[model samples]
Target: MTFELLEKLENKINQAVETIALLQMEIEELKEDKANLAGKTEQLQSDNDRLNAEHQQWQERLSALVGKIEQAEENA
Candidate 1:
């Protein structure tokens, strides 16, 4: 309609375009961060599994040792 109104509209359009660009960049960064976090989570899960296996093995060994100690004390 008027020149002033057209100028204001153009400024608003430019700002919207800039805001959209910033939002898109932020979204990309978040996606990358999520991928990295997922990979780290998988690695931690693997480590936990290995540790659990080792713990079970150690528990069995300890139980056997305790049994032997009890038997020795009984003999004494």
Candidate 2:
């Protein structure tokens, strides 16, 4: 092969290697982002569960208070 052709081939090979490296880095970054999102999702689910429990407790308290008020009204 001619010198010019060999030089061109080498340049193409170097470009391919650099592209591969960049793609690998991008893949790692995406993996990290996915893990972060999963953790955030878990935390949100936990928060939702806690809030639901608190809401149910408050509803029960409100219902009891209303019942007591109604009983008082009936006695009066």
Candidate 3:
């Protein structure tokens, strides 16, 4: 092969290698982001569950108070 042709091929190979390296770095970054998102999702789910329990408790307490109020009114 001509020296000029060989030089061109080498330059192309170098470019391809650089591109692959950059893509690998991006993949690593995306993986880290995915892990962070997963953790945040888990935390959000836990918070939602706790909030639901608290809401149910409040509902039960309010119902009990309403029942007492109704009974008092009837007695009066």
Candidate 4:
């Protein structure tokens, strides 16, 4: 092969190697981001469940208080 043709082939090979390296790095970053998102989703679900339980408890308490108040007014 001519010197000029060999030089062109080497440059093309170098470019291909650089592109592959960049793609590999991007894949690793995406995997890390996916894991972080999953953890956040699980934590949010747990918080929502706790809030729902607390709300149910408060409702029961309020109902009992209302019944007591009504009885006192009737007796008075």
Best by TM-score: 3
Ranking by TM-score: 3, 1, 2, 4
Please, what is the whole-model Cα lDDT of each candidate in the order they appear?
Answer: 0.99, 0.99, 1.00, 0.96
Checking candidate 1 for backbone clashes, the offending pairs are none
Clashing residue pairs in candidate 3, if any?
Answer: none
Candidate 2: residue 62 Cα off by (Å): 0.7
TM-score of 4: 0.72
Better of 3 and 4 by TM-score: 3
Candidate 4 wrongly placed segments (more than 4 Å): 1-6
lDDT of 1: 0.99
TM-scores for every candidate against the unseen true structure: 0.90, 0.84, 0.91, 0.72
Worst 10 residues of 1 by lDDT: 1-10
lDDT of 4 by residue, 1-76 (tens): 6999989999999999999999999999999999999999999999999999999999999999999999999999
Any idea what lDDT model 3 has? 1.00
Better of 1 and 4 by TM-score: 1
Candidate 1 lDDT by residue in tens digits, 1-76: 6999999999999999999999999999999999999999999999999999999999999999999999999999
TM-score of 3: 0.91
Question: Which scores greater on lDDT, model 3 or model 4?
Answer: 3
